[model samples]
Target: MCGFIGFLSNTNINSENKNNLTNMSSIINHRGPDECGEYIDDNIILCFRRLSIIALDSGKQPFSYDNNNYKLIFNGEIYNYIELREQIIKDKNITFSTDAEGEVILAYYKHYGKSFVSKLRGMFSFVIWDKINNKIIGARDPFGIKPFYYSESSRGLYFGSELKSFTKNKEIYKKEINSKSLHDYLTFQFVPEHNTMFENIKLLKPGHILEKKINQKTKFEAYWTCKFDPILKPQAEKIKDIKKALEESVKLHMRSDVPVGCFLSGGIDSTIITALSAKINPNIKTFTIGFKDEGYSEIELAKKTAENLGVENINITISPEEYMEAVPKVIWHLDGPVADPSVIPIYYICKEARKHVTVMLSGEGSDELFGGYNIYREPNSLKLFKHLPTPLCKILKYISTIFPEGMKGKSFLERGTTPIEKRYLGNAKIFKDHEKKPYLKSYNKNYTYDLVTKPLYDKCKNYNDVTKMQYIDINTWLKGDILVKSDRMSMANSLELRVPFLDKEVFKVASTLTLDEKINEKTTKYLLRESFKDILPEDTVSRKKLGYPVPIRKWLKKEMYDWALNIIKNSKADEYINKEKVIELLNKHKNGKIDYSRKLWVLITFIIWYEKFIEEV
Candidate 1:
């Protein structure tokens, strides 16, 4: 596990570019503080920072063969390397140079060619240079567990594990903000994966590969697509399969040369992981963080859950000031604006866990994979809208506006009357189009969220409404938001975080579960809860998602109201947003006339991100 940077250029690799490459790699040194390596040539340069997880003695990266005929730079762990290498030795009569995973990747690619990625089962973002073919190829994992960003310039193609790496060479890489992305960011609170907030640099989509040669257009294609063809089966059969798959996944994810532990939140996601992990390795350690008894903190629950599972639990309580102090650095580590307040404690927990362990197991993808979000139940609550005619639905939407704000079914009447895409853009809905009109100077009706979600919705046309929501989120909310912050926060602490819930085999079992199994009248993650009911605490099976709930709304009203007002008053946001309007909203919240805390937080984060990335201040 590490961070890497490389560029393929038509011009010579001069001393200036070499210096920039080294600086870029060093800035992300926290990602892999153990060791470093480099490979420089006339037309290309590959720099790597090593964290030394799997084969600590011989895992130095930029792994090459045939005297540099094929060089590699990778940023994630390949869990199936042992199996792949054994097969290559049997079928291709090839002998590996070391026990490290890179050689297995090289050998498998040599035999399978471009299709090699589809055969692997792990979280990875790897780039290989085929010197003989005069081509360089890069691929991100199926679930985007690792990150890959690149910029196309006249010089050539530059890529790296973090956006800051590309920013190191500003002579070639530009840092202008993408306004449409900012507009979308206000609604979603994070930029979409395919489009970064920066104009030139973009995230390579998960499950896809980009291949390019000198004087050739980059050819990009998806090596795999996670499909949901829910198979109807007995409840008992589905529960058994899910149980078997999760246990197997946890076993595979424990493949590490270093000590491994787990992060335990109050939510069942992490509780389930800790239970399964303790069964396999009873000595495993777990970590948690929370606040005082503010009705939202989860530390007490995490403690009880940890004791029930019989693992050493480390719990930390963060004061409001400590949480406030960590914001700037957290945003810096994040590489972009992510308004998810939960990241603060997540970052701190990873930092604390790093002192005791090198690798930590996390429960990130379970919610998205199993339809665990409470918002997913909207379709069931709004079933009446499906029976209404389209014209009548539109008329009802107009009439619903006349209803008071707290009136029953006001939101239901408004959302139920509209199409899914128009109403739902994943779980977040911060600012509506008309609301954003007061903020931005211009809006592109054509380039609205449909540019992102329509394609995904069209692909899953035959799925049930709940399944369709899960599909959209698995691609957008899961990849763009959840995994992005998860990677950045964990890596920021120089700790390797693995998600067994995101394993390919686990996803297969989850995909086979019908909507009823995922969410029913009583609870979310119904099948998952049933599968672990015998193992986990009975109350845990029905617990709501109380993981890391920071009191942002209260903070804005009391603790940070003055600080927030000054930020807006002093911000360059006036160029894009109406300061008077923003001030009005902030005042309304402070005076208890409204609850625009989320919108305010999103705006403040954007300002902070813009200043850090674009303004160079």
Candidate 2:
């Protein structure tokens, strides 16, 4: 809902420096174009840009508590702030002023200290400046709904809601790419937590807080963790509990002063959200994006769902050309390369929805929590790997290497033969290890596919195969890729997106369901569909899942090939990547020799990001 930038120094600051902080906040002015404010003390300077979501008239940023001893700047929504405030006042016997969520946050922090995060039940990333303790306390939300990046420079420690804010300081070094993060981006499409694509800058892990003491060391620790406790409860009992919990979460998430809307896709997740929302408010408006391509068009399904729910629906259809043109603007707004092609249309959708409402509800966390992805079906299909003779699997892998290029089923043979650790990097594995090695000028082993997957594999030692993949996704894929796109793209339009599926109460029930229930009968999200069977249309509850399907693959083969080639050929990305190799890959794809849609898109996005942010020109 807002953008904040602050710096904590070990020495006294002057007016000139204060002006610099003001300018830094201005760079991210788009995030909070409604209002702006700044607060500075001897060793800390806090600045805020307000978007005016809940308390438009009186809710300003840099809110202070305890006679200005506790000052803070925030970027996100606190849906349960009212509930939290009532509990704090009653439990701690605290007096408060202003109905602003910002004030409630300060009071809660004062009463609970670091433990305050446990009581919070919303998306947020904020920094609290403790004038008395001469320290700064910061925390990101539990599911990483909002982003927070910080860097230590000669000026001191600088923190901001977006990366561009920290880069606003001219003296601070910029354009120093973090190779590890870049490699991760190339592999996973988004940089995971604790690693940004820039050295000396890091994303605050979700559910974690940092405390930096003046003239001393800074400490970061997690305040919460999402632990899976799969239950073997009956299907009927699970469905009953799930529906009850999800409905309550949706009800709680609807608590806002402004009108709320829902993002409706043809899929079950969005359909269920829309169906539930319509039950509470029949006039609820739903937004959907339609593409010209038949396979990718979900607007018709969304329209059907809306008609069934009897809610007003808005469908925005865009041509491939329009989506391509919107890419650069979206990348600039995102502030980093989140190479999800779906981000483009999602950004446009939010931009369109913002015209009607300030706050919109979405179905984001359902996939991660309820085993929604078709890839979750992979462990079931690939369970044979666990029973395969190790030597035979290795021999099959060796045989796959001898298979000629362009041969059908070769990649399948390779993927089946190789260990899951090496083959299934994440949900979307664009480039094979062999293919990527030829592209990187200097392959950094430290950031290879194993770097991201090994830690996950180790953590899932005792978990079932399905649970292992789910746990790995929660740690890597969900926060690193999906949520990043959702949060950044939606916020870039200054629209507050609330995810009921991500609500802690909903997660509590979903996380407790057994893998068999989640992946029952070889189908993904079976439990979820069963829970909402009565509310959703019978056809919708059983429809094949088509996830945010972009026509990028088909476009790259035909219409967009020329544009993609031009970008990759002329991009300044040559400094880091092998230009000839990139062109070779594109040429092969264009000539119909290979399917390089995923890799070409990744290369094109990286080039676009470099041209916009890294290259000075």
Candidate 3:
């Protein structure tokens, strides 16, 4: 609902530097366009852009608490602020103030110190200047629904809701690209958490707090995580629990000062959200996007569902030129590369939805919570493969690798025989371990995606195979691509996007579902579908989750091939990429020898991103 930028430094606050803090606010104006506020003092300066969702007159930031001893600048909603404020007033004798949500953060932190973050129930990223302690403390939400970026330099520590804010600092802007992240990007399709494209900048991990004392090293510590300890219950009982949880979550998420809409994709996740939301508020507006490619479009399905629910549906068709032009603009808002092609459609959908509503409810995190991805079913078939002797399986893996590329059953043999940690990275596997070698100027096997996923796996070691894969995705893919894209794209249009499925209450129920409840031998999210089978359209409850599909594969082979070739032809990424080898991959796809659409999409996105940030800047 807002964006904030803050600077902590021993450097004197000069007039020019103060002007730059205002400039930083201008750069992220799209995130919050209603009002602007700035706070400056001896050793620190803070800036804020407000969207004015709640307490329009009283909710302005950089607010000082305890009579100027502590100042706060926060970006997000604290849904339980009323409850927190009442508790603080009753138990701690803290009294009377504006009804702003972020005030609870200051009140709680005053009494509980770092542990105060554990008591929050909303999406947030906040910075508080503890002037008395001569340090700063910041925290992100439990599931990373909000974003926080920070960098340390000789000037000071610069932190903001976006990475583009760092561009205001000369030193932070001059750092070299993080090649390790580039290689990992090609593999996982997004820069993983903790690291960004710039070597010096990093994301504040979800459910963690960062503490910076005057001249001491900064430290980060986690406060929450997803756990999969199934409470083996009857299928009927689990289904009822999921229904009650989702209903409660959807009701809580509907708390908004402005009119809220839903992005209906015709998939179970969005369909479920739309159905539940319509039941509460019948006049809710719904939006959907479709491509020219009929195979990839779901406008008809979404419209049909909208008709059944008797809610007004607004649908738009994305033209090729509009999609092409929005690519660079979308990358600009993303702050870093997210190679997921679906970001394109999300950008358009949010842009259109912003025209009619200020807030929208979306469907994300349901897949990771309850088994939703089709790939999670792989472990079911691989169970027998895991029963084979290790020596024979290793021999079979070697033999399978020798078969020609695209051979049937080759990928199955390789994945089934190998361990989950080695085989499953996330929902996507763009450039294989071998495929990445010839394409990058620098490659390190140590820079593998496992560096990002393995720790998550270790945390969920007690989980079943399907749950382990879900954990990896909830940590990596969901945070990096799904949530990031959803947040950035929606904020780019100055519209707040809320996820009913990602609520902590919903996750609590989902975490307790057994694998059999999450998935069966044939379908994913079986329990979730059956829980609302009667309410959802008969077609939607049984439909596959294709997401908001973008036909980049077909476009690259047809209409956009020349456009993509030209980008690779006159390239500036030679220092980071092997030009000839990338061209070979592009040529093979053009000649129909291989389906290199995803591989080329990864390259094209990164190249455009590199040009916009590295070259154009």
Candidate 4:
């Protein structure tokens, strides 16, 4: 709904700092073009841009409370604000001046202190300057649906909704590539944990809160974490609970003053969201995007789903040329490299949806929360290994190495023998440790994917393999890749994208699902499909998850071959990457020797991002 940038310092405010803040705000103006506001003082400055979702005229922020003693700048929607507002009025006996959620947040903070964040139920990243206490309190939503980035330097601490906002004020924060993040990005297709591609700047982990007293070091604490506690209940009862939770979440998420729409796909997740939304507003519109490529496009299926729900479907088919042309702009908006090919379609879809509506509901967190990924079925497929002795499995793993590359059953043996902690690294595994040594000029052997996953694995050691995998994704994949593209792509067009599936209420129901309920021998998200079987079309409910498929593999083989080769040739990343190795992979792909699309895409995305932020800057 909005974007904000600001800083806290011990030095007095100057005209140059004010100018820097203005420039920072201008860079992200697309996030909120409706209005802008600022709050400045001797040691702190807050600048905000508004899209005016809930309160239209009343929600202009830098909303203050308690005789202007506490000032707040927020970037997201508090779907439960109306309910929280009533609670605050009754508890504190305070009269509110505006309908803005930010004011309610301030009043809540005044009454309950930092503990107030726990009571909030929405996607948000906010900073509250407690002028009275002379300290600042900042928190990111539990699921990280909204972004918050910060850096510490001699000039002080700077924080904002996007990484680019900090680039404008170079004197306050210098830009340099973080080698560790780059190395890990090669493996995960995203920079994991708190570190970003840029040095000093770090993403505030979801469910975490930050507190900083003037001139004191910032302190962080986890306010919440995603953990699964499966309750053994009857299948019918669990299905009913899931249905109730999702409907309630959809209802809460639909609260907005502006028109709201839903993103539709042939897949069950989006189709379910659109189906539920259409029931609430019969005139609801749905948006979909696909490619001209034969197998890559889901337009027809989405159209059928939309027609079944009796809603108008707005769809677009992107060409190779259109996708190629949008690459630079997409990477720029992402603020860093995210090699997920799906980002392209999301960008185009958000651009198309913004033409008709200011707010759109999406189904992003469903896969992670409800175990919708195909890979979640891996443990079931590899059940044979569970029956084998550990020593025998080790022997099989050794024998697997003897088989040639691309040999049938070679990967199966290797994966079955390995422990889940070592084998599974969320959904995207672009490069292996040894593979990176050949591609990365400055590869650190210690900078393996385990550096990111091990700590997460340790936390959920008691969980089942399926739950552990979900936990890893809920922390790494969901926040790093999925939610990053969701926030950046939607904000790129000034459209407010809400994810009802990621709601705390919906997650509570998902967390209680048993492994058999989430996945079985035949399908994933078993309970989810069962709950919506009657409401959705049969094919829509039973369809396998294709995700937002892009024709990157096919495109790399033909239309975009030369374009990709040219980027590799002219890239300024030679100091960090092995150009010859990357070129070899590209050439091999073009010759149809192998499908290196994902690896090439990861490298190409980093190159484009490097040129934009490093060279151009």
How does each model score on lDDT?
0.85, 0.82, 0.86, 0.91
lDDT of 3 by residue, 1-617 (tens): 89998878767678877877777778999988998888887778889988878777788888778888888888888776777889999998877678877677887888899898888877889999898998899999988999999888777788899988777766568647887889889989999888999889989999999998776678899898778778878888888889998897888778877889999988999999999999999999999999988798999999999998889999999977788889889998898888888898999999999999998999999999989999998888889886788899989899888979888888888888898888889998898766888888888777777777777888888877899899989888988889899999999999999998887778889988888888888789989999999999898888988898888877877778788888887889888877788778788887875688899888888888888787777
Window of ten residues with lowest summed lDDT in model 2: 417-426
How many pairs of residues in model 3 come into backbone collision? 0
Top of the candidates by lDDT: 4
- List model 4 lDDT by residue over 67-139, tens digit each: 8899999999898999999988998799998998989999899889999899999999999999987879999
Q: Model 2 segments beyond 4 Å from truth?
A: none
Look at candidate 2 and tell me the lDDT of residue 458: 80
Q: Please, what are the lDDT tens digits per residue for candidate 1 over residues 320-385?
A: 788878887888888879988888888899899999999999999998899899988888888888
Tens digits of per-residue lDDT, candidate 2, 1-617, equal 88898889877888767877888889887788899998988888988988887877768878878899899898887878889889888998888778898899888777778788878888899999988788999999888888888887655788898887766676554777877777777877777777887888788998999999887767899888878888777788888889998888888888777889999987899888888888888888999997888888899988888888899999898888898899888887767678888888898899999999888998888888998878778666667766788988788788888989878867776867665565666676766555667778767665567877888788777777667777777887788878877877877888888888987888899888887778865578888988898889878988877767898888887888788878877887776888888888887887776678788778788889888877852
Q: TM-score, each model? A: 0.97, 0.96, 0.97, 0.99
Off by over 4 Å in 3: none
The prediction achieving the highest TM-score against the true structure is 4
The model with the greater TM-score, 1 or 4, is 4
Error of 4 at 490 (Å): 0.5
